[model samples]
Target: MAKEKKYESELLITRIFSAPRELVWKAWTEPERVMRWWGPKYFTSPICKIDFRVGGSYHFCMQSPEGEDFWSTGVYLEIIPLEKIVCTDSFADENGNVVPATYYDMEEDFPLELELTITFEDHNGNTKMVLQHIGIPEGITQELTKQGWNESFDKLAEILE
Candidate 1:
């Protein structure tokens, strides 16, 4: 009999922005603006392919400071224009095909994929953005992912400004 491994992990981030919900939504839907704040600081994302409707896909390449580039692609499960978006994200090769095996952040067993749900709400004149990440591998990897997302949102706010 084979032993069954247990998997557990989740991340949630809530942010209140001083911008309207519509503008915030546009930043996410528009490719040019999204590229400006899609990844971590010092990492520039120059390549972006966005299809804002349901069942569409968003793909991009993030270039690190040392000229190393990483490719990430995701398929939009749901998109409620100005309200919410749900997608499944994964690390991919140059042809956008998911690699059969990969090491992430030095964790050989870490899951290279995650499901993300992003919600935007209007709070008076301010916008509240809630991001929920599920299915990430456990331990330090999850924590690192949360921090990375927070930093990305911080960058998003700056771009919105």
Candidate 2:
């Protein structure tokens, strides 16, 4: 029997956007701007509610091209103005209660909640952001999540341009 390869439990991505750090921070904190680029390619964020402060919560609804809605809710754990944000992320119902990924018909191994840390820095008049998502499932789901984030970043870049 072939042994399964162990994978890291976290996903990390770093990208530089051709915008100021403050602009990138606003893009994340403002509901209207987040609605513009919160999901993968072809996925639209039709509803976004943000309470951007420590201990506050946010809810977002991403609709697929086929009209399936994916809801996510998270509570802010830490917030550093124009610099960093740490939150707890999870699948959620329209009412913003946390749910297991299986609630969305996804893999059972997906954690009920995940930690997300994002840090922003100024890079030659641009913004360099680092994203750390912990507790992603240790297999294909992680890859898919990374791809989704990349696609969303692509959309964000286009909007910034």
Candidate 2 lDDT trough over 10 residues, lowest sum: 1-10
Tens-place lDDT digits, model 2, residues 126-161: 999999988787678989999999999999999987
Residue pairs in candidate 2 whose N, alpha carbon or C atoms collide under 3 angstroms: none
After superposition, the stretches of candidate 1 with alpha carbons farther than 4 Å from their true spots are 1-7, 100-106
List the candidates' TM-scores in order: 0.88, 0.94
How far residue 160's Cα lies from its native spot in candidate 2, in Å, is 0.9
lDDT (10s digit) by residue, model 1, range 1-161: 10122125678899998899998998888889888888787888888888878888888888888987788888899988788999878787666876532622455554556678999999978999998887666677778778777888889898777
Cα displacement (angstroms), candidate 1, residue 68, comes to: 0.8
Candidates' RMSD to native = 3.0, 4.2
lDDT accuracy of residue 149 in candidate 2: 98
Global local distance difference test of model 2: 0.91
Regions of model 2 farther than 4 Å from truth: 1-8
